[model samples]
Target: PRRIVAGRIESGSLIAGDEIVIMPAGKIAKIKTVESWPVTPVAGRQGAGRSVGITLDRELFIERGDIIAHASAAPRETRRLRARIFWLHDKPLAKGDQLLVRCGPKESRATVVAIEKAVDPGELSSTENKAIGRNHVGEIDISLSNPIATDPYTENPRTGRLVIEVSGRIAGGGLVLSVDAGQRAVPVDIVPVESALRLDERSARYRHNGAVVWLTGLPASGKSTLAKALERRLFTNGGSPILLDGDTLRAGLNSDLGFSAADRSENIRRLAEVATHLARNGHIAIVAAVSPAREDRATARRIADTAFREIHVATPAGVCEERDPKGHYKKARAGALASFTGIGNDYEAPQAAELVIDTSTRTVAEAADEIEQMLKTSGVLFDEVVDLAANI
Candidate 1:
């Protein structure tokens, strides 16, 4: 349903013989026909104000925000750029601001790195500055997360003007100045793919497939207790397992981090990375953390991607407060503690968890047994391990 309704093609019409390429994706194609709004062939007779659609010789997976240009004159591609920004937002546009930058058929998330000069419009001359105030214009350097196909505004006015958005609202605009060429990662990003010793090879030795059973809920909600018991149950049944409790990790690997939102995100990211690698190597990782935020847990899901199951220890907050083994709830109630999961920061319960176990209604062994059954039904346990699971 996307039509390239840009300027008309009077002087250089895209007829059947012309060779063109798509920007950002440099795929070449032959021009088939140029049509008007009602799908009638324009035959290279349209003016500069006309908007027409062009059909290609072959089908391509072209998206809405894609530019079709001549193969001989392909546009510049870059990640870093200097742009003259016309600030329209009420608040000052400063460094480190993440904005959606849209220029012609290119769009990406751009971060303001440095504000070179701000022109107050009245003064006419430029002055050194770090931010652009409302109704002001500034020259700034921005970094894009992905390389974009662009051209200098001086060369092409329509393809170089950019609109910047903050939180889904258009806040300002920009005119392209110069672009630094595409960058390459210093350490490289490729990982080893071919492996003779794969997951199946490792699992054959352990007699059980690796899995991560993440127990998450309010603090003192029996998540750790059930995880520990499940870890022991797997170990007793001739399977290897490791417990990654929140308290234990906070004491060591995540000791330097705090309970802030950013810190919590990093903590969960690190845990998921570690668990994913461990699961790939045929080791069961039983994580017992009061991962209060559902979004954080969702991030963990993406990181692990496979062989991961979220088990919700859905013990009630009242029950957790009553069974506050660490006395955190009491301290929070007495104004002695901050950022307490159950008391201070409200825990966001998993809306669609794989399994939900309430310790108030079931013992630790029963909760662990339920998880073991889930693992067994999901094929995480081998035939021999299944027989031993019942015997244990």
Candidate 2:
């Protein structure tokens, strides 16, 4: 049976007199005639992906995966494949591991054979092999078991294909290399449907820019209070900022989660998703939680496109205990509370905070003023506001 492959035309359309090239298995063919749902006589009117069939003027070799286009638009061929693979396996991926890759009508058994580089998807920088663990995306170079038809992903997405299978399970996924033929990596912004909806809506709503301000501190260390104060400040300045406090969101958004480490991470992840959505819509989002893990904070920052400002409400533990604002800290110390961030659990301070507020020393008004100043300096507050704030 003849293979019937359907692909969108990448360039100039088909016409009776137009010249075309089929590549990877490079061959030249001239168009004898064009056919589609409706026939038209126009020559130059053919465009990308109009679903037209072309009758070649000469009998030439053409195959299912061969790219047919103008000679100038033909994609370059490469033997090696570079890609970003998202390892879904629980055992993690290592260098020199063999796997199968499927691209278009071609398939090859490839050896991951070498890890040219590893990356923290959240950081987007080259890092040493800690391990490509479950759910982590990393760049890799693979030696194909056999050379097959291939093209740069940038030129034709459909032709640049890859799949990694292990133990009879699909372990990873990747896209063909477009930028560097020597290195393979996937786009960093891959997310599920709900996340895509949030990102799309947020970007459309916020015309200028949007971001989340993650405020982290111990309980009674003033996270909620500071977040509320900041929200009010932004509102008065004609900005639409949403505030998501730990106590408030826990009452609804995260009520199902418990206080274990895994549960805590999930809770923060949900909040980050919501904050990312709000920020994408052009609303400044203030998230007040004791997101005690550095990894959790990094996840939030990675998801928020515009800016992720970590504000450490650096109120001393002594001061927080004295205030006994919620009496929760006392309970935690007395073993009445479990999974508390500061008393029993750990709180990783932001190593790269954009701003740190010593709430113990400064009044709410003072901290708000400082934040407004920072925003002005960052050029988000606009000139008019800066002038007014300066005058005040």
Candidate 3:
């Protein structure tokens, strides 16, 4: 069904045949027609400040909360925002407060991540505070559950102003200062189109449930070796398996990331997302990476949920350095590689891993056998019983 987007054009103009982009979702379409309150002889275009209704060339999943703009000049899509706000509620505004952030027609559930500073506008003074008092101004960081399309206040006032709602009532208003660069939009940030195939159908056909097998450890700790062996074992057993090695990902999907804490976290987040996507489609995702931080691994677990299986490759650092298949340990010791796990850096081992393997003493086949058995025990891998049932 065709939808007529009704709104006042804060700036620019919309003409028939003009390509427009729907924000947040990034759906693009052409303007098919424009309607005005006072019917004009020519209703092909509507200029700024005029309220009108415009229909697109084709139907899209547009909502009341979506912004329509010129495709070429679309705003940034981000979940993290920095803003200066005036708290109007009697209750103080505190960090971690849950609120609804509304900018024009778009609104999203948000959390006050930080209270950067509280200001007493009347006294022209400011101080660091955990909360902002009633009628006071504050600079804060807001994290949204979903990304919004917005521009900086200085750049476009129309899309930069926001209001906070607490308990369905307006509690504060703000102007967006900037968007966190690290939390900016990625190519996969658009709304997802669901697949038609059902998970149970895939499971019934494959005769097994999909899962993400995450192998995390230090460099040369035999993560890749064990991952390869496990992949071969799963494939030989008639299971659909895909291996996602860290080095290979770095050379492609994660090439933009580095060894910094933030980069590492982003790298793991992307890997987890990709692995989860694969697992959701009934494929075993075998991931081997030196995901150092427990927090990052936890995030991955949250992403993969019940499909996640964390396996800590507990190979000793001495043995890892000795093997140093890639000479990373020597480089780290020579100060050539900084923050190298098991050397210059620290690795937080999983406190509650599903399994722990010390490759220093175990053969590749042995490690793979243990993993396969674990999968069987967890019901992720189907056994001969399922095979016989399928044959029947």
Most accurate candidate by lDDT: 3
Query: How would you encode candidate 2's per-residue C-alpha lDDT over 195-232 as one tens digit per residue?
Result: 43443243333322477888998778888888889888
- Alpha-carbon TM-score of each model against the true structure: 0.57, 0.48, 0.58
**TM-score, predicted candidate 2 vs. hidden true structure:** 0.48
Best by TM-score: 3
Q: Model-by-model lDDT, in order?
A: 0.77, 0.68, 0.84
Q: Which stretches of candidate 2 lie over 4 Å from their true place?
A: 1-208, 384-392
Global Cα lDDT for candidate 2:
0.68
lDDT of 3 at 237: 68
lDDT of 1 by residue, 1-392 (tens): 53443444422335545677766656677777777766577665344455677777666656556666667666666778889989999889898776778876456666788999999998787888878999999999988754577777887776678899876699999898887753311222122344456666566566788887789999888888888788888888778898898889989998987776546766887788788778877899899998887867987887677788999998888999999898999999998998778874478889988899989998877888799888878878766633433333
Q: How accurate is candidate 3 locally (lDDT)?
A: 0.84
